[model samples]
Target: MEKKIITISRQFGSGGHEVGMKLAQKLGVKFYDKELVDMLAKDGKYNADFIEANEEKCSPPMCPVMPGFSMPVFYQDLPSDLIYKGQSKLIRTLAERGPCVVVGRCADYILRNMNPVNCFVYGSLEARVNRKMSMIPEGLSFTREEIKKRVIDVDKKRAKYHEFYTDKRWGRMEDYDLCVNTDKVGIEGAVETIAAYVEHCK
Candidate 1:
C-alpha cells in the first residue's frame, strides 16, 4: 500500500502547512507548498508574488471586478483564473510524476480524479489565533485580535476560491476524505492521522 498522492486543504492558521510538510517527511515523498507557485512562475508569465496573491483565492476570477480594478472587455481571463488553470495542470503533472504531498492551492479538488488522499485541516478561531500569534516574527507588532482577523480573512478567501473553482462548498465534510481538528490532535497528531489515512486507502 503506497501513498501515491496526498492533497491537504486547510484553514489559514490551522498548522496545515506544518502537518503537510511533516507528513511528507514521514512518508518520504516530495512536498509542494509555495514551491508550486515557484514552478508556475518559472515561465515568467506570472511572478511568485502575483501567483501567491491570486492562486489560492478566486479574487472572483470569473467576475469582472476583483480587488483593485475591473477587467476590461478585451481581457477575457483574469490573472487569478489563468493562475488557477496553470496550477491545476502543474499539480496534476507533479502528481503523475510520483508520490507527493501538496498543501493548499485547492490541490485536493484539482487532484480529485487521481484517487489521491484528500484531507482538510482546521481548528477553532481561538486556537488558530493562538497558533498564529506564536508564528509571527520577532519584533513585528501585531495584536492577537489582528492575527485573528487575518485568520478569518484568509479562510474566507480560501472558501471563495474553492467554491468558485470546484463548485463545491469549502469545509464541507463530505468533500474531503479526512478532516482533522488541530485543536484536538495538534499538528503532529494531525500529520500522523493523515499519514495513517493514506496508508488505509487503496
Candidate 2:
C-alpha cells in the first residue's frame, strides 16, 4: 500500500495540534509539528529559536525578530523561502518513509504529489478564544477580549504565511479533502471524522 500521510492546516486557537497528535497516536504513526523547526535548524545554519517563531509567520524582506538582517529582494531567495525549501525537503523525506501526521508549514501543498490527505481544522471565534485562553502559558495572563484579538491576529499570520509560500489562500474548504469545524463537533469528533477519512483513502 501507499504511504498514509495527513496534513492538517488550522486556524489559530483551534486544537489542530492536539487533534493531529492524538490522531497520530491512535494510528500508531509518527507526528510532525514544531519538530520540523528543530529539524531545519539541525544543520546549524539557521537558529532554532528564530525558525520556531517565524516558520509559520510571513514577514517579508527582513527578519521579524532580528530587525537588521534582511533577505534579498528576490522572492524566491527570501529567508522564508530558504526555510520553505528546507521544510519541503524534510517533509517529503518524512512522508516517503511511512504513515505520519504533519501539521502546518504548508505540508499539504508541499506533499501534494504524494497524495497526502489534507485536512483543515477551524473553530468559531468564541470557541477559539476559549481554547486559546485555556491553553495559554501559566505565567502569562490574557483577558478574554485580548485572547480573542490575539486569536484573530494569529489566523491572519497563518493565512499570510501560507499564501506567501503556497500562493493559495489558507483555510479554503475547496483546497482540502476534509474540513472540520471544531466548534460544531469538538476535538474528538473532528479527530474521529478525519481518522475515518484516512482509513477510507485508497
Candidate 3:
C-alpha cells in the first residue's frame, strides 16, 4: 500500500492538533507539529521560542534598529530574507522525508506540488472560546475576551502569511481536499473522518 501525507491547516482552538495526532496514530505514520519546530530549532541552532515567533510572522521589510535609536542599520547576522526561507526549507525537508501529518507553518502551501491530503479545520466561535478556556494551563488567567482576541489575532496573522507567501486566500475550501468542523463531529470524529479520507486516497 502506498503511503499518503496529510497536511492540516486549522483555526487556533479547533482541536486540529488532537485530530492530527489521532489520525497519524491510526495511519501508523509520524505526526509533526511542535516536533517540527523543535527539529528546526535544533537544525538551525536557534531556540524554539525564536523560531515560533518568527515562523509565520510576515514582518515588514526593514533594516534593524540600533539600541540607542541612533539610526536604522542592516544586520548581517540576521538577514531579513532568511526567516521565511529557513522555515519554508524546513517544512519541505520534513515532507520529503516520508508520509507524515504536518500541522501549521503553511505546510499545505509549501507541499502544494506534492499533492498532499490537505485539510482545514474550523469551528464556531463559541466552541473555540470554550475549548480555549478549558485548555488553558493552570495559573493562567485568560478570560473569554482575551481568548477571543487571541484567536482573531492568530487567524489574521495566518491569513496574512498565507496570502503573502502563496497568494491564495486562507481557509478556502478550494485549497483543501477536506474541510472538517470540529464542532459538528468532535475531535475523535474529525480524526476518523480524516483517517477515512486518507485511506480513500490510497
Candidate 4:
C-alpha cells in the first residue's frame, strides 16, 4: 500500500487537532502534534522547555545601541531558528517513516517532496471563541473576551512563524489541498470530508 501523509494547519480555536486525530484514527494511522516537539527535543538534544517556548514563535529582532553610533548586529543563530531546523528535520523524518497526520510546525512545507496533503482548518471568530471556552475545565474562569484575545494572539504567532520559516502566507486556501471550515461543517463532517479527499488522492 502507498503511504499517505496528511498535514493539518489550523487556526487557534478551531478543533483542527481533534479533527486530525479523528481522521488518523479513521484511516488507521498515527497522529503527531505535541509529540513532534518531544521528538525534536529528543533527537536534537535540545531542552524540552526551550523547544516548547521557541517552537512556532518568531525571534525578536536584536538591535544594540552604542554610544554615539549604532552598530550593525548580525546574528548567526537564534533560538527560534534552531528550533525550526530541528523540528523541520523531525517532520521530514516522520514523513519518511510512514503515513500519519501531523499538525502545525509547517509540516506541509517540510514534507513537500513527500506529496503530503496539506489542510487548513478554520472557523468564524464567534464559533472559535465558543469552542475554546468550552474546552476550559470547570472553575478555570476564562471570560469570552479573554478567549477571543487568546485566539487572536495565538493565530498571529502562528502566522508569523509560518511566514518566517516558509516564506508563505498561512491559512491561504491556494496553499492547501483542502480547507475545512469546522464552524460550517462541524468536526465530524470536516473529518469525513478530509478523509474522502485523502482517499481520492490515493
Off by over 4 Å in 1: 60-75
Cα lDDT, all candidates: 0.87, 0.86, 0.83, 0.89
In terms of lDDT, the poorest run of 10 residues in model 3 is: 75-84
Local error of candidate 1 at 51, Å? Answer: 1.1
Q: Which window of ten consecutive residues has the lowest lDDT sum in model 4?
A: 68-77
Candidate 4 lDDT by residue in tens digits, 1-202? 3448999999988999999999999998889999887777776579789999989999875655457666545445678898888888878877888999999999999898889999999999999999998899987898899999999999999999999989679998889999999988999999999988888895
In candidate 3, clashing pairs total: 0
lDDT tens per residue, model 1, 1-202: 5867998899988999999999999999999998888898997888998997777776533435556665544456777789989999998999999999999888888888888888999999999999889888998989888898899998998898888888679999998899999999998999888877787797
| Candidate 3 per-residue C-alpha lDDT over 1-202 given as tens digits, one digit per residue, 9 for 90 to 100 | 3578889999989999888898888888989888876777777667788877777667765666779886676644342245567767877887798989999877888888888999999999889989999989999898889999998898898888878778678899898899999999999999988887777784
**What residue runs in model 4 are displaced by over 4 Å at the alpha carbon?**
1-3, 62-73
Candidate 4 local distance difference test against the native: 0.89
Question: TM per model?
Answer: 0.91, 0.88, 0.87, 0.91
Instruction: Flag regions of model 3 displaced more than 4 Å.
Output: 64-81
Pick the winner on TM-score between candidates 2 and 4: 4
Cα error of candidate 4 at position 85, Å: 0.4
In model 4, how large is the Cα lDDT of residue 127? 94
lDDT per residue as tens, model 2, 1-202:
2438999999988899999999898888999998888888997878897677667776566423344646433344566667778888999998999889999999999999988899999988898988888888989988999988888988888898898888688998889999999999888999899998888888
Q: Which whole-number lDDT from 0 to 100 does residue 80 have in model 1?
A: 76
